[model samples]
Target: MKKTVTILLFLLINSLVFSQSLVDLSKREKERRARLKGKTIIIQKGGDPARKGATLKTDPSGLAEETEGLDDLTSLDRESPPQKRMIPKTENPPEETGADQKDATDLQKLEEQLRKAKEYVELLTLKMNALWQEFYSMDDMKSRDEIQRQISETYLNLQKAQANEQKLQKDVEAR
Candidate 1:
């Protein structure tokens, strides 16, 4: 049984190798020619005279004289017209009405908002530092309420800062 299995395996491997060996250039050419069997080769003396004649028929005269009568072909050589003087058109200047007052008012509003936001951020940072100190203190269980309060305050301040930032963006865009 072992001898028969080994012989069968050897035959399979030999057959695979022989199949690959038959795929040479000659076989590829034979398959290509078989596919092109019904096609006729129209070889003229100058090799496909139709394409050459088509290109020649597109323009009888080559590129040089094609533009012969394109623009003012007559050689009269008359004096050209005098160059026209082009005066720049008049435009109304922009009007500036009470811009200074508006700018000052907007500046004051922005400054007040920035100052309030800064104070809120500073308060939040101080609360965070206090919480950190309490956490790292010798008595760990103490001041749990204070730490939670500080975290809540920080979250509120962050939300306020985001709101302020959005307001500032709107102000800039309005300008």
Candidate 2:
């Protein structure tokens, strides 16, 4: 009987608290609306208000008649059509120096190799981590040995990639 009375009292308190919170929110909203009741919003962009709906009025007879004024920009050709500009064909284009071009290409190759080496090192590092995780999760001796070997191989490859990346980086910097 005590438990029933306690549960009923808890439900009644919770309902009262929730209803009071709703009333408080509504009161705040009413106060906010009252504060903004007499306010007005206005946006002023550019341009003169007197010329907002005005447009340029051109002479209708000036369409076909040529005018002597310097501001006359209307051109009407009631004749044939327009012609395309003709370009003369050349047999040979000028060639660039081999040494300059070769050096740029070499630098680009070194940079590309460095980028690939960095990516490979990152890949190998992930592979090494996965190998270690697999080794830790397993209990079989043969599988552990296999994973150890793979870890060693990945470590070696990672070292090689790092060295290659360092060498390429130096070469790129020298260029």
Candidate 3:
């Protein structure tokens, strides 16, 4: 059985190696040369056909002289009118009215409130983390329960402060 499997593996490997051999190009080259030998080749430098020189004729009245079956050609030197812009014009500049001034003051107050709320949230978060660490090290169940409650309350306070900060930010943006 081992010998049969080895022979089959060797045959598969050999078949794959023989099937992937490089293609022969000599026959194709000979055929291509034979086909090109009877053709008249015109080799251009830029691969474009050579342009025949043609001049535009103008009449005595400074108009383009028409040619047979060529009525679509216009003078290339004519000046086109300037294009008009489609954008709307803002004629009135923004002025600071009383309502705008009130909004600015309200924004300032909201920013101050948000700053304080963020500081409160940070303090509560740090206290909660410290309590958690302390709760892990405590051996008494009562102390651990107390620490857990404190941590929960601190987390709640932090969430409230964060919510207030977000509300203030939204209010400022709305202004």
Could you give candidate 3's per-residue lDDT for residues 1-175 as a string of tens digits? 9999999999999988766652335667566556444432211122122421122344444344323232322111111122232556579947789989788768767877766565556545656677778889999999888778877776777778779878887876787
Q: In model 2, where is the ten-residue run with the lowest total lDDT?
A: 72-81
lDDT, candidates in the order shown:
0.50, 0.59, 0.57
Q: Candidate 1 has what TM-score?
A: 0.35
Candidate 1 per-residue lDDT, tens place, 1-175, comes to: 9999999999999998888878775799678656545532211122322321111111222221121122321111111122233546559735556887678668766755655455445434544565566656636444666556656666666667657767775675676
- Which pairs of residues collide in candidate 1? none
Alpha carbon deviation, residue 120, candidate 3 (Å): 1.2
- Find the candidate with the highest TM-score and give its number: 2
Ranking by lDDT: 2, 3, 1
Question: How well does candidate 1 match the true structure, expressed as C-alpha RMSD?
Answer: 34.2
Return whichever of 1 and 2 wins on TM-score: 2
Q: Residue 125 of model 3: what lDDT?
A: 61
- The list of candidate 1 runs beyond 4 A from truth reads 1-96, 138-142, 169-174
- How well does candidate 2 score on lDDT at residue 37? 50
Superposition-based RMSD of candidate 2 using all C-alpha atoms, in angstroms = 28.4
TM, every model: 0.35, 0.45, 0.43
- How far residue 157's Cα lies from its native spot in candidate 2, in Å, is 1.3
